[model samples]
Target: MIRGEVYEYTIGNLRARIVVVSANPYNPQRATFAVILGADVPTPKSPSLVPLAAGDPTRGTIDMTRLRPLTRENLGARIGRLTRTTLVAVDDALRTYLGL
Candidate 1:
């Protein structure tokens, strides 16, 4: 999957949604694993949470602090894609969180 695509991922007994944060070239088509961040709506406020697009039906905040590597096998179906603006916001949040 390409970057900014949302998918369902199961971690242990918890099934959660995640956003594909890895660049397209480093995703499943080329790499064994990809980077991702957990996604949720109406969560507690934090600097690590980047607000999503207001127009999206599935609008939610992406938890930048929950970043992790996901295996290709664990990557689930495509749930949604982030808007261009939202993706840019996420990129900025990532940079800030990582101190880049």
Candidate 2:
């Protein structure tokens, strides 16, 4: 899978969006990513999140709430990809959030 592609992983009852960002050569099963939750996405216990809607087909505001270092073992199927514009927006938001 390439970066910017959104994947739907089996997360019990929640259908969360997983973007395949940077992959780690050290661990093939894992990658650095952000979780995109729909507009109605539940309030996360953690306040860290970036708002995104530019590429989502549903056209709902998505929350890139957390940056996760996750394993591909749980990823189920390919869903879609975020646009170049959306990816740029996310990167900007992330940089701002991290005070970079």
Candidate 3:
């Protein structure tokens, strides 16, 4: 697995579009964590969505406010991928989230 790829993974009983925010994949024992998206429409740079595009729908919006820690047990099926541009924006958001 690679960073920036969006997937429809199931965490417990709920399923949502989550973006892989961690680095390095080969190891599948545990997932560092991910940003989860929901039916709630995200707004630009809000506590929820960062830079919401008027007509853009690529990956889960950069939700700096939330994340989920998953493992091989909770990791579910793959839904789709995110565009490179959006992924880059997400990377920026992540850096901001961590203040790194």
Candidate 4:
């Protein structure tokens, strides 16, 4: 599992942090909603997020860099779809990171 945090800075406010979790170590495509909390801090409600990293590559597949880009206005849905699609493409690029 891959675990991390995300921080967002507002114009006049301190930066906020959210916990990131993934199912696979090598793939961000397999991540799911684990938790959201203060930066560099863990909370009681924090879910055990896991990494969704891919395991291996497949034969006769195109590179991930050649694939089309995905965009979404909804944060939740966009993340869900991105994770699913990323894991599916792990065979082509080994793993994909959205850097969300």
Candidate 5:
């Protein structure tokens, strides 16, 4: 999957929504694991959380603080993609959170 794509995955007994944050090329071709940020609702007030677009069906904040590497096999169906603006915001949050 490409960056900015959202997908569902089961972690233990909890099913969670995740957004792919890994860059392309490596993420699609080379990498065995892709980096993702869990999406959670009731958007909390945090500098690291990037809110999804208003029109998004899966409304939640991308928790930048908790970056998890998920294997391709673990990832489920494609939920939805982030809007251009939201993706940019996520990139900015990631930069700030990662100190990049």
Candidate 6:
């Protein structure tokens, strides 16, 4: 079974979760690998241009044309990184367990 902690972080009004797991493969008594999941957030940067009309009435314009699109892309990248990291950790754990 996978065991880990879920860490939450807020970017602007968005909340994101990051799951971290320490896997024990070698001895079943020691943590052999670390797995990180979630932790998805848009990179800390602004887009090139702002949209003409965007944002909530109470929050004002959010620059939908640029920031919104870029935010999605950034989030995707973060998720991709999380997935890769988790896979690598799992692979390592399996390899260690099998003496590969």
Q: Rate the local accuracy (lDDT) of all candidates.
A: 0.68, 0.64, 0.59, 0.28, 0.71, 0.29
> Model 3, which residues run further than 4 Å from truth?
25-30, 42-44, 51-60
lDDT, candidate 4, residue 81? Answer: 24
Encode model 3's per-residue lDDT on 47-79: one tens digit a residue: 335543434344235576676665655566665
The candidate with the higher TM-score, 2 or 5, is 5
Candidate 4 lDDT, tens digit per residue, 54-98?
421211222223222111121221121224443344433333334
Clashing residue pair totals per candidate (backbone < 3 A): 0, 0, 1, 11, 0, 2
User: TM-score for all predictions?
Assistant: 0.77, 0.68, 0.68, 0.22, 0.81, 0.20
- lDDT (10s digit) by residue, model 6, range 1-100: 1233223334577654332234424223332222222214233333321111122111111111221111222121222122344334444544554456
Q: Which pairs of residues collide in model 6? A: 17-39, 18-39
Position 7, candidate 3: lDDT:
62
Q: Say which prediction, candidate 1 or candidate 3, comes out ahead on TM-score.
A: 1
Q: What is the lDDT of candidate 3?
A: 0.59
Q: Can you tell me which runs of candidate 5 are displaced by over 4 Å?
A: 29-43
Residues 1-100, candidate 2: write the lDDT tens digits: 6667677765667767777655436336557677766667565443345455655543443455567776677787777777878777667666666777
**Candidate 2 backbone collisions, by pair:** none
For TM-score, the strongest prediction is 5
- Which prediction has the highest lDDT against the true structure? 5
**Candidate 2 ranges beyond 4 A from true positions:** 23-30, 42-55
What is the Cα-based lDDT of residue 26 in candidate 5?
68
C-alpha displacement of 1 in model 6, angstroms?
A: 20
Model 1 global lDDT (CA atoms, 0 to 1): 0.68
* TM-score quality measure for candidate 2: 0.68
lDDT of 5 by residue, 1-100 (tens): 7778888877877677887777877676543222344353355677788777776547767788878776676778888787888878878887888799
